[model samples]
Structure formats: structure tokens, C-alpha cells
Target: MSTTQNERLRGLLEPLVGAQGLDLEEIEVSQAGRRRVLRVVVDSDAGVDLDTVADVSRAISAKLDETDAMGEGEYVLEVGSPGADRPLTEHRHYVRATGRLAKLQLHEGGELVARILTVDDEGLDLEVPGVKGRKPTARRVGFGDIAKARVEVEFNRKNKQDELEQEEEEA
Candidate 1:
């Protein structure tokens, strides 16, 4: 699609998505076989559930049907949330990722894999694990120092609070 048309689509759909308390993260139109596919990525601070995604999809489809935004061709509308591996671009993205492990690419050099402790307007506070079983050290990384960041999947992660609750339940 043309840039103007994409901008127009963004203008029209952003408000509709925002009305449901979600941000329109992306809009992409591509060809699939003989039909066009329109993919819309939506997200929120609290994250999006399956039902919420369905609701947004219906709203977006209806809005498109009511206009010539998709032109005369048949287009498939796919509205969904960003995956866990989505790049952390906006500050709100970092804020929403609090408590998650992130691998940040530093602007200066090197990469840092740390668990996010807190996020503020200035930067993020991370817990960088020390060598072996040593105590994890807290590190403050300014946003300006980050080139790119993505959430890392943690397997076999055990939460002490959760373990305690389970033990109490068993007791």
C-alpha cells in the first residue's frame, strides 16, 4: 500500500483501537496469494487477552468495511498483540516489561542481559546477576544507553513467594 493510504488507515484505526484502551503498535499490508493481508498489532500496559484481541479485530474490520481504506480488493484483517520477543522501542514498552528479563544492546558497546526491576521516565533499574551463586547486583541503565532491547524467555523460573504459598497450602 502507498504511504498516504497507510497513514490514512493509521489515523482512522488508531482512535478506534485507543477507544478500547489499546495502542496500535503496527500496521502492515502485504500480498498473500491473490488476496491482500492487513495485519494490525495492538497492545496495552496490562497486556491484551484473547477476548480483547477479538473485540479489537471486529471493531477494526467493521471500520474498514465502512470505508474505502482497503480499496476494492478483499483484505484479511489480523489484529493481535505484540509477541514477547517484540523489540522494546517506546518507553512504555520498557515500563510494561518490568519484572521480565531483557537483553539490552548498549549504544556504546556490548550487551547486557538483566532482569528489569523498575522503569521510570529517565531509565530502568535492572538486576544483573553476579558470577556463580553470588548476590545479584543492581544496575541503573539509562534509556539513552540502550540501542535495542527484547524480553528473554525464562524457563524453570521459580518464584520464592509462589513456592512459599504452595508449601503453606500443602501444610
Candidate 2:
């Protein structure tokens, strides 16, 4: 898509997504065989569920049908949330990933896989897990220092609520 069409799509959809309490994470137009695909990525602090995806898809489809913003093409619309391992590009993305493990690549040279302890405007407070049974350490990283970051999926990691429940059971 041309830059103008991309801008137009954003202009038309951002507000509509925001009205539904979601952030417009991405908009992409790609080709598959003879068909074009318009992929819309929407997200929220609370996360996006299938129902929410469906509703937002309906709204976007309706809006697109009503506008010449898409120019004149038969395109398939796919609306969904960012995947589990999506890059943490925005401050809000980091904030939403709190309490999750993330792999952060630093600009100065080095990478750290840590659990996000907290997030503020300045940067992130991370708990870097220790190796060889050593104690974990705390580290601060300014957003400027991070070259790239993505949340790591931990299949066996227990969350605070689970730990708390276990402790209560023991008590």
C-alpha cells in the first residue's frame, strides 16, 4: 500500500479501535496469490480475547466498506492481537508485559533475559534470574539503552498468584 493509503487507514481505524478501548498496534497490507490481505493488529492493557477480536473485526469491516480509504480492491480483513512474543516497541508495550520474562538486547552490547518487575516513563526495573543456583539480581534499563525487546514465553513458570496459593495450602 502507498504511504497515503496507510496513513488513511490509520487515520480511519485508530480512533475506531480506541473507541473500543484498544490500541492500534499495526496495519499491514500484503499479497497472497491473487488476493490481498489487510491485517489489523489491535491490543489493550487487559489483552484482546477472541470475542473482542470478532467485534473489532466487524467494526473495521463496516468502516472499510463505507470508505474509499481502501481504494478499490477486494481484500481479506484479518484482525487480531499481537502474538505472545511480539516486540516490545512502545513504552505501553513494556508496561503491559509487567511480571513477564523478556529478552532485551542492549544498544551498548549485551542481552539480558529478565522478568519485568516494573515499568515507568524512564525505563524498566528487571529481575535477572541467576544461573547455577545463584540469587537473582536487580537491574535498571532505560528505554534508550534497549535495542530490541520481546517477551519470552515461560511454560512452567509459576505466577505470583499460584505461588501464593501454594503457600496458603502449606499453611
Candidate 3:
């Protein structure tokens, strides 16, 4: 699909996610087997839940049905999180990934796995997550050349904090 079409799809899906308190990580359209698959990747500060996914799926499916955005034939709709393997690519992506560990794939063929020390217009500061030898190699990767990057879903204590806050609210 054209870039414009892809962006349009993001625009269309954003509100649906926002209303349901989820971040629309990305909306991808690609072929799965002989059919088209519209993958709606979602997440939230509280972590996404099944009910949220079902609600999002129903809402987006309705919008797609109304607009016929997929065009011709039937397409499978899959609503999911970006999973632990996907990389963050944009500024908003970085914000969403605050306090997470990430693997950076440089275009020059190298990898840097670090905690997102910080993010700014200059670049991302990745604290090399290991011993003294690595020394938190926070090299400046231009906004370009980041081939593929993603946050790793390691068990973090803050996840418990988030859960507690959610429970407090629900109570």
C-alpha cells in the first residue's frame, strides 16, 4: 500500500485506540497466506488486557467495514500488542517505551541492548545493560540508520507498580 494509505489507516485507528485507553502501536497491512491481514498492534501504560483488545477489534472492524478500506475480498483482522520482539522507531514510540529495555539494530550491522536512559531531539541514550567494560555505550544514532529496534519484555518491578495503581483505581 502507498505511504498515504498506510498513514490514513493509522489516523483512522488512532481514535479507536484512544477511546479505549490503548496506544495504537502500529497498524500494518500485509498478506498472510492467500489473504490480507490487518494487524492492529496495541499497548497501554497499564498493559493491554483482553477486554481492551476485543473492544478495539470490534471498533476497528466496524470502521473498516464502513469504509471498505481493505478493498476487495475478505481480510483477517488481528488485534495484538507489538510483542516483546518489535522495536521502537519514532519519538512517540520512544515515549511509550520509557523504562523498558531495547535492542537497537544499527544499519551498519551491530547490536546494542540497553535500558532507554533517555530520549531527545539529539538521540537516545542507551545505558549498556552490563558490566564496566561496555560502559553504557550511548552513541548518537541518527534518527536514520536504525534498521530495526524493539523493547524487550523482561519482568520489571514497575510492572507490579502499574498493576497496583490499576487495582487501586478499580477499587
Whose TM-score is greatest here? 2
| Ranking according to TM-score, highest score first | 2, 1, 3
Q: Write the per-residue lDDT of candidate 2 for residues 1-171, one digit (tens) a residue.
A: 889889999999999999999999999999988788999999999999999999999999999999988668688999999999999999999999999999999999999999999999999999999999999999999999999999998899987799999999999
Encode model 3's per-residue lDDT on 14-94: one tens digit a residue.
988898888888777888788988888898767777888888899999999999578877899999876765667668677
- Model 3 misplacement above 4 A: 2-5, 106-110, 132-148, 153-171
Clashing pairs in 1: none
Stretches of model 1 off by over 4 angstroms after superposition: 163-171
Better of 1 and 3 by lDDT: 1
lDDT of each: 0.94, 0.96, 0.79
Lowest summed lDDT window (length 10), candidate 1: 153-162
Question: What's model 2's lDDT at 80?
Answer: 93
Q: For residues 20-120, could you state the per-residue lDDT of candidate 1 as single tens digits?
A: 99999999999999899999999999999999999999999899999999999888999889997889999899989998899999999999999999999
Give the range where candidate 2 is weakest over 10 consecutive residues by summed lDDT.
67-76
